[model samples]
Target: MLWYVLVAIVAILVGVVIGFFIARRYMMNYLKQNPPINEQMLRTMMMQMGQKPSQKKINQMMAQMNKQMK
Candidate 1:
């Protein structure tokens, strides 16, 4: 009846909230363990673009990327 319908709606809402948090935590852990980019990848990309990759430049780019991520 109407009570069953109400319970179903509440259960669905709770499930959605829990699922969102679970997914968010998983993504944060995954990103921490496997960043989307790395120094080597940056070097290769710079080489493709014909820009000489230097340690200082690489470090600066990494810092900027990390700052943006936060």
Candidate 2:
């Protein structure tokens, strides 16, 4: 009975490790295949780098970026 329980525990642990690796691999591949970007995402990232961006400044920057993009 003790041996059976140990084997079950080991199996469960191995399964958990495999699942974690599979999920991480899938996520990494998916992200590499599809790199996402948008103005809002860039703004959020910039805000996180320092202070929160004001709406006025954000709007101004958005306009500038739009002009540049065009």
- Candidate 1 contains a number of clashing pairs equal to 0
Question: lDDT values of the candidates?
Answer: 0.95, 0.77
lDDT of 1 at 62: 95
lDDT per residue (tens digit) for residues 13-66 in model 2:
999999999999998777656645456876797788996877777778767765
At residue 69, candidate 1 shows an lDDT of 70
Q: Which stretches in model 1 have alpha-carbon errors above 4 Å?
A: none
All candidates: CA RMSD in angstroms?
A: 0.9, 10.1
Could you give candidate 1's per-residue lDDT for residues 1-70 as a string of tens digits? 9999999999999999999999999998898789999999999999999999999999999999988876
Q: Among these predicted structures, which one has the highest TM-score?
A: 1
